[model samples]
Target: MAREPLHLLKTVYGYDAFRGRQAEIIDHAIAGGNAFVLMPTGGGKSLCYQIPALCRPGMGLVVSPLIALMADQVAALRQAGVKAAALNSSLAPQERTAIWQAMEKGALDLLYVAPETLLRPAFLERLRAMRLSLIAIDEAHCLSQWGHDFRPEYRRLDCLADLFPDTPRMALTATADAPTRAEIVSHLKIGVENSFIAGFDRPNIRYAIAEKDAPRRQMLAFLEAHKGDSGIIYCLSKRKTEETAAFLNERGYTALAYHAGLDKAVRDANQTRFQREDGLVMVATIAFGMGIDKPDVRFVLHLDLPGSIEAYYQETGRAGRDGLPADALMLYGYEDIALRQRFIDESDAPEQRKRMERQKLDALLGLTETGQCRRQVLLNYFGESHAPCGNCDNCATPPEMFDGSIAAQKALSCIYRTGERFGQAYIVSVLLGAEDERISRFGHDRLSTYGIGKEHDARTWRSILRQLVAHGLVNVDLAGHGGLSISERGRDFLREKPALMLRIPARTGGRPAKAAPHEVARGIAPADRALFEALREKRLSIARAQNLPPYVIFHDKTLVEMAVVRPRDRRALEAISGVGHSKLERYGAAFLDVIARHSP
Candidate 1:
């Protein structure tokens, strides 16, 4: 095999070693083999194809969907002194001409284009005439109808097999379950034997989920620990994104709103600022964050429930891409579930697609209400078994499990006695013997199940009922007004009186202190914090001057390492993880100067 990949890895990217399966994947690509790669986000999937592209004899072609992602990757690649350019609608005519001329002369090592650009007959003919190194399809899951983010344009990508029959191709994605994987293989016409299934686990991210109680207050409490950190907050609606962004800004935080409803220029400007600035929180809907390559996102907070486990995983995976400690906090409630279910029920999709969506939503609910390690349940959904990770909220603070069998029996009985026509609020009220007009009209107050749940408070009952829905003991009627009905399993529980363990909801009140035990922060030492901040200011200054994202210059992890190590000169600084020959030559002295000034 060739030794150039390793040499390039050290000299160009400054990493001393190849990560898991990276060497094998790169070797396979260099040997002209096609494959499907199932690596998680931040798993260095790019290097698997990038290294081989450089080692091969011709220019590499990357097919991407997002213009911003293409621009970001090209900028980063050029920062490393590699010949990279992007051909997208955003480029000027002269710029496009320059890129085309460069491609024709083999002056560019890699060229990124939208799938539409690559599929154009003229562009395809030009590419056919060139000596192609390799073709890499990023976010390949979009090609699968079973995938969460399906685009019709991606379906046409299968034609690449006929167009470039001799070029090695690799389809890569971070979020794909078994069915999605099978669909990708069938759609791309790649062999299943060539698949590399890197296990889906982001240990650096701490997973936390709470039932929505005073959501804005809870969001504030969570943000307290992450002051001045870059993060994203996902909402379910455009109005909520605007309101939340305004709310956070009023509270003295730098926040921005993004949605498809906004003007294209305004949306692009907000996204550009979020990318170029540091410590800005972006509140947006699902329209944002598909191909965002920001690495230092300290947290990802979801104010509303995502549609499925795959959507949740893909969104939360945006955080901690630098492999540093980060947090993923999601606050969901019964209303969120009802809203999501109604969306699925109202969609124009076929019955089979709707059924698949229901199952996916059920899987998400199972994750939210599970008493086991949240990571374990999430991985299990993706067909991987993992031991309980101690990093999630459940593992960090084990919930108080009580025998909820009596509570379950009472709830099931109340739903049945009340004719299963009311939602959680009405059912809880009936169980608590509330004197409401609806209850009096229905004469539920006279039922045997009435007043039987007076021992537990309203909050406790709501928790129990929600868990029942999650456990499949209850079903919500999306076609109706979210009426609750007992499932067969719930009836069996009433007859057999099976023991059920349920978690007591945690108490919420008051603002938390600055640093909570579970809150993950940069692992910088107290003594080195000053130097770290100084280095960050320096990096940000340089980035602003160059109009590039701070991460493209150097990731936060590299800064933390530099702060701790206090690299004093060129040689010592070059030993840092991200300091390659190009960066060391261009940026080494400036960073060294900052470190020297902080010295005692």
Candidate 2:
């Protein structure tokens, strides 16, 4: 039993060895110890429990968040020659009965279920009758209110601890801040000693942010480099998603729209298409991408600002899950921040929650406005330290900064003189001494601070005010009017006359240059390109015939390895990564034939 996990890794999952703390986490679970795992998305988290369930006695029970996610995991497990089943609302009556019988007979290795189903009285009674290996919870952060994606059903999961006191319980998630981790620990009754913090850093993703200037054109420009690649464009609204999808399709790109308003069948079909097909861009709102398992997403684009840094990290983390180079670009403006703030203010949440939301929004804005290393700032939020990652836009093209002490003072004075009633455009107009009718009507033209900002263009001043808002020196009014007012911090700065440095506005749309070509194409030798494409076509054909996503059979990374290694026989092929026993027995010959034909 001790050596079974390592044996299973090489024979079943086809990996040379465990990564990070996976060996320890799996051993802990197998030894009937509770555990908490906070690994990044592509950090081989599932193996921690999957290997344990196989090594231990009886069937393992996994609590998952979404039906689609559960189904995907179940499929992948079954493909690996494991006896896995999912019990959810999507299962037919006969299918559910079969699963129950399988569980009762102890013939199943693992079962994936939602909290709603697992907490039912009948379900709990049936489960108590059977010997269990362990109980694992995926996406455990959903149990906490501080978590970005909170679900009420997840809060009731702690009851499992009492119901099965002897059974080991493990909670796993890819995203959680310190506070959220604390809440999860408290809520689930998991011991603090079992917590494993596997750092929040996805080095394969290149982060970039640009102010929204001609958003459609900017989107097109960014997409130009990513053409014929699978990506997701996240919009702020459902209508915007549809419009963006249509815009892309009209310009000779394959795109689809997804949101909560769509019919259930349509949504499911679109999601399935996005998963099974390559080079299809999914233009969707926030409602679309929580549980998607597509591993080869080449990029993730945010058309507007997300609510918080946690949300941004989770969304962008969805890309580059295959450990390949992927891109994440965000297009934002001052209006997006105001809109997000208005949402927080207008919600029915308590005052405390509203304050927390504001702080989260400010942190996100700081990420967008920071002239320093974006990855460093992001990792610092999660209580981890990383050197300036050269992958992000700021690290690639560093922003120039200038002293703006007097400029900030003048801007603050104009905001105060205008009675904090005008938005940014009006304030910028007054600073430039525009003879507009609204200015004369408001009598703001007579203010002493007017025209004092003529040295900087409106773009520069706008950039200054944006940073000011991000730095907490200025606040946007919550009435949805976009009015700006100084905070206590701004007043302190005015009194102290401290020097401030602001980023100079980039004139060329503020976007990094196009990312390099696909990682696989750039990685393999030119002679091997033909074999790589042929192997990809073979994988796609098998995937389509089996009605599974191409990645479920083999990730592009694995295919790239196959193309480079060019193994000659079954023994040599089995030595390649991702060629587990089940996969080798099933599809090894087909790939080997392609390699043989193309070998020179």
Candidate 3:
């Protein structure tokens, strides 16, 4: 327990100093205090617990949420010269026996287990037999029943405190609001005062949200700039996941689909390829990112709106984990927002839960239509204060703001006039005097509101109504064919005629995303792009030879730094950021040869 964490970070993980609060967290956990940590992805959360686990006396037990995450983490740790293994259902008979023997002999430094495996009574009894050092619960937000990634097994982990009262336990998650944090504290039985909230702003990830117009075309346009990079595209449904993946693959992009509907082996393989290869895009539902640890994911795209800000943060946080510039683009629309609310309304979840879900959706929708900086609004949700990040889409080009008070009044009047029983499409058509079957049958065209909104087109009106829903002036009633219902706020607005400003998306060109900034900007000057690719090829070859993922051999960031520094000799190569003593000793000469072959 008295070992120095900075020493472990240097020799073991190949870093010099702790990035942010990692040193503080490590110190806290090493001193045998029950610690709760909330850190964003790519913020070096693993080291916070890993260092303490190594410094402490007994074996460190990490309760991870996903098998892929466990495997990836264990592999990365082993590559960094630490003894780590995962005990999940995926292990073979001999593998499990080997871990058990290792545990009995006090040979493991860090061992990861999934909730399902860790919660079994037999497993708990077996763990009781061991001299436990620390219990680290990664993705501890799963303990919150209200959060998106809820797990009942996580609720059972509170027993660990009762089971081993003296063992220092740590709960860590990238996403958790105050309520969820309270739940984690209550369920994990950890001290609320001991909790640490790391900064939620991921400045490395540029946030962009676009209205879903010609989604595949828009998605294609966005993907054009991201060719030859790894990314994730999230769809709302399984069918969409497959179709999107196929469509992208048909267009010559390396893409794969993953969902619970797919066979487990297929899901596993798709995940493995995404984890191990470059330039592969995973088209998946929410099922994909619970525990993914790929460090070089260049972007994370959402084809549909996420249900909550917590989910959006966690999913997008998956990108740029290596402290490099990455992108988060989302394409959403009125229907997408309405559809999410419809789900929440239709669910049998408790009334209080539904209210919370609706509020969460409203918050996310506000981000989409907000005129303020996207980064500012998002960080505000996590209780972190940040200036407008100059890099986000809003900061790059602010949305046009017009006096939407009249438009808001007209839209709310329309919802009120329609008996609040028809969906937005029908309402828009009624406004446009479409004379469609629904409009004609409703005989609501006779109303003064009808055809009065003809000043704006149907699409514009739809956008207005969607923003109205986002503004909480309108609600979606799923029981009535996704009808737009007027809220009390809407009624009050109608009565008061308040001045409202709505963000209007630019009609056309604003700014085109640069194509492959990582390669273009960082790859310029001393780092000959050709040499970097050659170095990447060499690293890939070594990874394949060792049967390890390419990043395990050396992350993309490390290779880029090498090309930039152009370390001519073995000693200089050892000074690179990710090149630890063991890594430098093991693969230093090969990388040095590659660097030397293409030295400028």
lDDT of 3 by residue, 477-561 (tens): 6655777888888888889998999877557632224333554237456547777889889988888887778888888888888
lDDT of 3: 0.85
The 0-to-1 C-alpha lDDT of every candidate, in the order given, reads 0.88, 0.89, 0.85
Total backbone collisions, model 2:
0
Name the lDDT of candidate 2: 0.89
Which scores higher on TM-score, 1 or 2? 2
Residue-level lDDT tens digits of model 2 in 1-600:
233899999888889999989998999998999999999999989898888988989889999989988978888888888899999999899999999999989899999999999999999998999998989999998998866789999999999989999999989999999989988888888989989898899999999988776788888888888887899999999999999999999999999999999999999999999999989999999898877988999999999998899999999998999899899999887778877977988899999999999888878888888888999999999998999899898999998889888889999999999998789999999899989999999888899977888999888888888878767788888564889999899999999999888888887755546665665566789998899899999999999999998889988888898889999999999998888899999998999999999997
Superposed Cα deviation of residue 500, candidate 3 (Å): 2.0
Candidate achieving the largest TM-score: 2
In candidate 3, stretches whose alpha carbon ends up further than 4 angstroms from where it belongs are 415-426, 429-447, 475-485, 509-523
Please, what are the lDDT tens digits per residue for candidate 1 over residues 116-199? 888889989888999989999999988877667898889999998888989999999999999999888777878888898987
RMSD of 1: 2.4
Alpha-carbon error at 491 in model 1, in Å?
Answer: 5.4
